[model samples]
Target: MPPCQSSQSFALDAIDSLVRCGVLITEENPEAAPVCDFWKKKGSLKWTTTDDPYHSDSDCEEQDLCSYKISQPSRCPDMLFFLCSMLAGHLRTLCWATMALDLMNTPLAEAEFVRQIHSHLWNTANQKKQYYESCSEEAAHTAVRTLIDLGVLLEERQTGGVFLGVSPLFQLSENRQKLHYFITQYLYS
Candidate 1:
């Protein structure tokens, strides 16, 4: 399988594991164990982690199989730090991230945004139904809005068209790190 397919596979396996086991453990600090051990063991995905002991506070559990509750202690507080991929199963955000990375540090135009994303998804996954075929203009807009709300993307309105790129709200170094981490965690798993 391709790299992108492998990542999505890992993500699917993670969802399956959580649904089956009802729990996933982690360390108190997110940086200590960025990826949960349950995912590693279940998906056989080589996710990086520190040799830190798991703490009670990091024990995120599913309150009920019927629905997910944010109030549950098993939902780690550090999860709030995760990007769109972690919180949502949608692939649009990952597509946007892929487009930005393809720009090689340049800005992307909003006019042809969906096409760019579609091309990236197609090239990476080599699948029609799951990648390019599933992408839509509405999904792209929703993904952009999600990133904008999270302060990860900036939208610029010009005379002819709009542009999208890393938000100026963060320092250059911080922006680079955040983008790198987001892509690495989701697309490269």
Candidate 2:
């Protein structure tokens, strides 16, 4: 629900910013319009965009006319950070393992990532989907490579195909905590 509210705020902020920046402006205010109608009443000569060119803040007081404006959070945040923390190390580890086994560091577009993630799930479970004719070969290859690079799983290039090298780190019964420790140390360092 909070994320939904953020999305709504982002959308309205976007519209106001767009109109203010002259990226997208309405020629005439509609009856159902939410935009500031001062421009329609006055003229374009009276408006001035604020001083900052890089970031947008539309609180200019010099002009009576303006594009629609809204107060936006200076740096809008996403819910993913909270969600990721809730997952903690275990979830990141799981994702790392699965992604390594499928397609690590493979530059796939967002849609491709979703599709590859589903395929990775199937592969990890060793289950076959009815329609599973093929999977994202590139993503899978990339994941295996990532696993190797991250030392999560060792890899051996052999005849016919690649085989997993034994990973003493992951093989331990206390692998999760150990992995968390190592990952934190490495990432933080």
Give the candidate number with the greatest lDDT. 1
lDDT of model number 1: 0.46
Per-residue CA lDDT of candidate 1, range 1-189, in tens? Answer: 456565445554554455444344422443332211223324333332223344222335422212221221355644433543353435444544434443534356765654565455445445434444334455555665655544556678877678866654332654445555554454422
lDDT of 2 at 60: 40
Per-residue lDDT of 94-161 in model 2, one digit per residue for the tens? 44444332243433443344455546644644553321322344444554455555454555555545
Model 1 misses residue 179 by how many Å? 4.6
Identify the leading candidate in terms of TM-score: 1
Per-model C-alpha lDDT, please?
A: 0.46, 0.42
Candidate 2: RMSD over Cα atoms? 19.7
After aligning candidate 2 to the native by TM-score, how far in Å is the CA of 63 from where it should be?
Answer: 57
